[model samples]
Target: MSTSAPEDFAQALAQRLGGQSVRQLAAVSGWGRTTVSDIRAGRHIPSEAQLRDLLMSVGADESEIASWQERRSAIITPPAA
Candidate 1:
């Protein structure tokens, strides 16, 4: 992983889904080469529900998103670190 923060990750996703060259989109989004390649190859951007469902279907943990959401909320509400 590139150690990009969660906020950057969110912004990258937003911009990639926004208007831009698909190739440039990967660089801007800070995604791994493989991830970008796979996405471009048509791995659909899964919705939160779909992702959660998929995680459960595959017997993987899905609690991390909740933890991330909590951390994001704290960052939003608290004084800057």
Candidate 2:
């Protein structure tokens, strides 16, 4: 998989939000607004489960969720020398 910057991943997740408010997404995902806001703002990279919940709350299908997970992984995992 290709590497992705943290900001790029955050931007892609925000786009998936499709104009939904942080409060709304947090409610649907059973998380706090600040958590959602942080994730959207690239200030946080959530755990895998949290990411799954956030993606699902935004209506992301399994494939989409997996894609996001991959992107997140790319950002966190270091490249080989």
| Highest-scoring model, lDDT | 2
- The 10 consecutive residues of candidate 2 with the worst lDDT sum are 1-10
Q: lDDT for every model?
A: 0.45, 0.87
TM-score of each: 0.27, 0.88
- Model 1 poorest 10 in a row by lDDT: 50-59
* lDDT of candidate 2 at residue 65, scale 0 to 100: 86
The TM-score, computed over Cα atoms with residue i paired to residue i, of candidate 1 is 0.27
lDDT tens per residue, model 2, 1-81:
764488777887888787889989999999999999998887999889889999899788999889888888888989999
| Candidate 2 error regions (>4 Å) | 1-4
